[model samples]
Target: MNNKAFEVLQKEAPEVSEVWQQFLLKASALDEKTQNLVYLSVLSAFHLENRIPFHVKMAKMHGATRDEVISAVLVGLPALGNIVTTALSVAIEAFDKD
Candidate 1:
């Protein structure tokens, strides 16, 4: 929630950020935990390691276990290979936090 890009978007383009949040809410047909898990996989696939910790925490808040977080990070390994591994440590560190 304290991400710099998100802060900038909220400060400089509040309307766009609000609309994006609305879109996410409206488009979420999957259960929250599942959606967060899917988001983790996509983040991993894209090598979005910086974003992983936030989503990993969200996933944990939604009842995702540590193993689920690990699996989500590795889910993209087949298609993306080792690039997905870059997110594993980041995701685990986030998930393991209190």
Candidate 2:
């Protein structure tokens, strides 16, 4: 449970965050809101709840509505409905937090 290591690394190399943003920016076909919604769906499908909040905020910032957020979270209904539902709750909490 040594979170400090990651904190230090990110502090020292904040450019990693920027690099990821830049990479994400390369997908020209999708606008920012759509991209964020896709990211939310992917994260939920992968059970990566930790990132749901960040993506939710970004989605809202990029014009995703609450209903759209819910829909995005439920993208893979047949295969991952349960997990995505949990992620939906997290997404809403995070959206409110933002």
Top TM-score model: 1
lDDT for position 68 in model 2:
91
lDDT of 1 by residue, 1-98 (tens): 44798989999999999999889968889888888999999988987788888888888999999999999899888888899898988998898887
Question: How many clashes would you count in candidate 2?
Answer: 0
Q: What are the per-residue Cα lDDT tens digits for candidate 2 across 68-97?
A: 998889988888557677787898888878
The regions of model 2 sitting more than 4 angstroms off are 1-10
Q: Sum up the clashes in candidate 1.
A: 0
- Could you tell me the TM-score of candidate 2? 0.79
Q: Give the range of the ten consecutive residues with the poorest summed lDDT in model 2.
A: 1-10
